[model samples]
Target: MNKLRLRVQILFTILTNGYVYGFLKGKIYQGPLKYTCVPGLNCYSCPGAAFSCPIGALQALLNREGFHVPFAVLGFFFLFGSLLGRFVCGWLCPFGLVQDLLHKIPLFRKLKRLPLHHILKFGKYAVLFFLVFIGSVFLFGGFAKIPAFCKYLCPSGTLFGALPLLTANPLLRSQTGGLFGWKLGILVLILFLSIIVYRPFCQYLCPLGAIYGLFNRFSLLQIHWDEDLCTSCAACENACPLSLTVQEISRSPECIRCGKCVKACPVSCLHFTAKSNGYSTKHQTCVPPGTNTV
Candidate 1:
């Protein structure tokens, strides 16, 4: 399942960002498809992107006149989050795929875990609430011409958009300034960190992943665990790419629904199920981490 999903994600990445000729020719695809919003963080300014990023579009709407709500974008988020939660992050995000591949590079200095891994997972929520939402509504709404998160913090934009454009277009070189330097620095840091950590950006900074994580507890698609069939061997925990333990396998907000835990289950005890279908597993065994059993 992981292999098939990874292949699908790579295909989606290629399909969404397939204008290789545009990258070579130093031109952004300014077509009708640009009006559409992709759920993941592929930059709209990327020369090869077939659609606008939802966050970028949301920021644009927020920065515009009349204080109108973006119903389409909001609905898209609601629908996708309620259904798949961070499954999109696991199976569709181009940036997530990049980080996953980077972490696969054979290194003895493998950073399988980080200090304060549990706490750092909340950083994405702070980024979503403060930078993407409040900053967009207030700073961009009032004083700023550029979206704060995208202009400053988005490594995806710097890696996929700015760098490529700068490399492809010599004419655009004169426009580079201090902001470009800062973004480049951020991109470099994230790229380096991602080599050591599993999805450092996704776990600690992605606003889109944060938004989807909110729906993880109640999303229609979920990982269900049958405790009766379990030995606490901790294989699932070991297989998990993220910082999840065997206990949090069912509904951890940090879970990207990558199916690593399910694949690692020895007894076929973990499986995907609809949230509406209640399992017969004992309540004591089913509660998330820190509430009941460790």
Candidate 2:
């Protein structure tokens, strides 16, 4: 397989099995642990999670019975987003990485590209609004709260997070009702669609990705383009899984910072840059150090 396929498979294996190292005799390893913010919408409830899930923490913050903003959690979210943009989604997220692998299946190909891409991209924001504003605010009635995103949507939480939790805890499973069934149905639908469509959850329903995407343009870590060297070859545009035009927005909200465009650019005109205090500088050469570029 090619490098992209290899990377996707390696990521999948790491996400699924690498966490095994942290578990011992059916319990989490108790050594001094450190947590970092992961970019996509994985759940903190997962037994293997090394870091807190921003969406889960966001809901908990909003659901706090009193007047308290979970500053630490929100701050971490912003800090991670500002530093990495959607790099987590591109390279780190288990779910996003899964979609990347699924989309590579040659049997299921996109019928058309670009025509409806812009319109469909709005769904993720809608999900964010509904969960944060309508569900969290309008419907919050004391501790009797519903994690709207996870309850009604969020397949990642359902499949990777909740299902495992339920399987491991019989008490949690016995308490399940119609709502749980509905969410499970939603998860099943999403999983089925993922086999055919390219990351339907990330594209349409990931609130965390939507939030991080807002900072994509101004994020400290970003894609830099040299307009002088670009031929407008459309190769980058075609390579983008999110269907973004690199020229229009190299750091667009839809751009996951996946580096597909960077690799696809025939002239090697695109690269990553680190920005500080409104100034940008190249951080890494297009090619790895000591590697010869063709």
Position 147, candidate 1: lDDT: 75
Give per-residue CA lDDT, model 1, range 174-207, as digits (tens): 7999989999998888888888888899988999
Indicate the residue-level lDDT of 102 in model 2.
Answer: 69
Cα deviation of 87 in candidate 2 (Å)? 1.5
Range of the 10 consecutive residues with the lowest summed lDDT in candidate 2? 25-34
What are the models' TM-scores?
0.89, 0.80
Runs in model 2 deviating more than 4 A are: 1-37, 111-116, 140-144, 276-280, 283-294
Q: Which candidate gets the maximum TM-score versus the true structure?
A: 1
How big is the RMSD of model 2? Answer: 5.4
Residue 48 of model 2 has an lDDT of 67
